[model samples]
Target: THARAHLPAAGAAAMDVAESPDLQAQLAAAVHALNHASHPSARLAANQWLLGLQRSPHAWALAVSLLASADHPSPSADLLFFAAQMLRRKIQSPDYSLPDNAAQLLDALLVAARRFCLAPPRLLTQICLALAALALRAEGGVDGLFARMPHLPDPALLELLTVLPEEVAQDESGDTGVDSATRCRFARELLMHAPAVLEFLLAQSEKPAAADGVPLHERNHRILRCLLSWVRAGCFSGAPASALAAHPLLTFAFNSLQAFFSFEVAIEVMTELVSQYQELPQAFLSKMPYIREVLLLPALANRSEKIIAGLTSLMCEVGQAAPGLVAEGSNEALSLSDALLRCVAFSSEDWEIAESTLQFWCSLAHCILGIDEQTSKRNATQELFLPVFSSLLDALLFRAQIIDIDEHCTGRVSSIPDGLVQFRLNLEELLVDICLLLGAPAYINKVCLFC
Candidate 1:
């Protein structure tokens, strides 16, 4: 093929396979040897050969051909995955380029991603990643690159959107070879695209079910996951709290929690938003009443351990994010605190869910006892929390009573389980904080009872 003749030689001594078939055969043999070779030296040689192949200009075209090939029988999954991976690397390489062939490369990636959208998600992910890298590296950014990609199926498009923010986040963190200036520019472009992306997600989520029969819950879960990736990437930074609060995506996330399939991701989305309270106080504040009424409070009463654990962590997130709220003794704060108290004191041998509240308790103790100029305010704060601290101390003491376990069950006869030891250490730190607040002698007497 004329394409092989035009392939830029990798180096002075790099071997050149003369045709597509020859190159494909060489890559397959190398992959097999690297995976299945019995001898160390043969495997090492294959690894070296494949690494050398990646550096060749031919690798760019070869990867695309392997990914998009339909003329021959379908390639092995390993070869296809390698091809997708290679395409991503080539796009990411600062020194790698096909100045005039970028459009062709982008089209080829979309084709490959579309072909493999149903299964073996890893290959599809790599193809999407390659497209994302190209978008960052291309001239007009996401809009331009995606503008060229007008006909992708919904699943492929969603997958691409899902990976775009993740790729941008990964790149902005300095893992990619692209220079800081380029990554910064790309990130700004992505943030610029956030509104449109959110709109896209809302539109997709509102469709009762996809034309292709993707379940409503699954679609919403993916949409929420994409929103989370963007939020973590700082795409929503400086957006108005009111605007974010009113966004359909936020509403959709809240709504998703009612459905079992989407509940876990929905909790994560809510937790992330709650965590951003310091940055978007009004946004999270506006939702706090709803969160307490519809989500946290109700979830706390449920008997499912998973629900209890998730909502407990979320409640703690709110408490830690706004220790002052806990100090102020708002009805909302009091209610969430009551929920946390139940978590700590809930009857269970495993302290894992209870342990989630330790940091919040420690933060509250700090708030109650930290140096304050207003003696009256300090007293009021201490007065409000003293009983809560005392109750918590009692729960900790009750929880600390040692219990015998079958030696074989833990696989250690002498040493305490690491989990138990860590739980006790954390409890000790919180106990000291409680001791300062409730009076040392009272704390000592409480421990004496446990002793």
Candidate 2:
């Protein structure tokens, strides 16, 4: 009787399986059996069956709960990966909203993340990525996910950063098979909303002895670059930059820049700084002397034309914000003017560099002229602006000679011809502007000598 009863329910019950309470009970039994079964194949089959039933929320919650339990110490890697995939799908699903138990689930995942750090690096990275995704989604749904994760200690946060670069590299290389759009979305979310996480990363960079075999400087630089990228990406949105600036994390960034002056990092950080705070230049000049020598100068004297253009725009920000300070030998203005003259005089083989250099000179001249007219130190201002203008015109003359030499040797007259035309036009315009501003023929004549 028992065998026959299990074989087929006969009559109406068997025919109406969809509505049968017995059938529902049978399916629940199967799901629970699969979840607890000792056999790996049985667990996989159970998950597949649950997925087929579209038990998204229930399956995800169970997976998260299983991960949270210390007794469930070592779930199969396949099971964990599938769980992560399901969670990701749930996040992407339009119909899915944060579950009532989301905060509990997130809390569980944070615990799991800490545990996963004790696992191998490959597994550790995957778990960290999954937890980051969950946290990011929780952020979007919950008003304050950070506040909710009050128990998430700094150790867990630092562990996440430890594996972040691996995850990023995998995602970037399509190793994780995550799409670019999704990766970018995750990065932007983490960067904008997770200030504490970023701060944690910055703090980790400061403690060389605490780092687990990773070079402190290399780690610090990479972390700094990553945060800078996030800030730049969110510039139009305004939220990320403002959030970062308001956080204590910025102190780490500022201190890191002060410790090391890589041309690349400096340019990136400085550009973001100026974009976020128009007054940042004055602040930097007042506090960070090293920033002037390393980052600001190389940027102004960058041989790359595109870099020079960006540097010029940055200098313009400096000039516009504090004309009086800039003209009065403020570290930034003096260093910038010197760099521009050197770049103009030396990097003349590239026509574009020469052109940018001249344009930068004009901007500097304009700023100086403005300061001279408005300030009490008229003589000192004239003295500063005059030498800079003379140096610029001399650079222009030097460039013309070099171009003529190249033209004479290579018979590339056309290459040099356009530059010469532009040079003359700029020189004439600069002279006229200076004459008008200075109200003196001698200043015009001094500029004319080099032209």
Per-model RMSD to reference: 5.1, 12.7
TM-score for each predicted model, relative to the true structure: 0.83, 0.51
* Superposed model 1: Cα runs more than 4 Å off: 1-19, 29-48, 94-100, 171-176, 277-305, 346-352, 371-377, 407-413
Q: Which pairs, if any, clash in model 1?
A: none
Expressed as tens digits, the lDDT of each residue in 337-374 for candidate 2 is 66555556655444555565554455555666665355
The clash numbers for all candidates, in the given order, read 0, 0
Once all C-alphas are superposed, what RMSD does model 2 give against the true structure? 12.7
Q: Where does candidate 2 clash, by residue pair?
A: none
Q: Which 10 consecutive residues of model 1 have the lowest summed lDDT? A: 1-10
Best model number under lDDT: 1
Tens digit of lDDT per residue, candidate 1, span 233-346? 676688776776777787888778778788888878878887864644334544556655676556666656777787677778777888876788766666666667777876
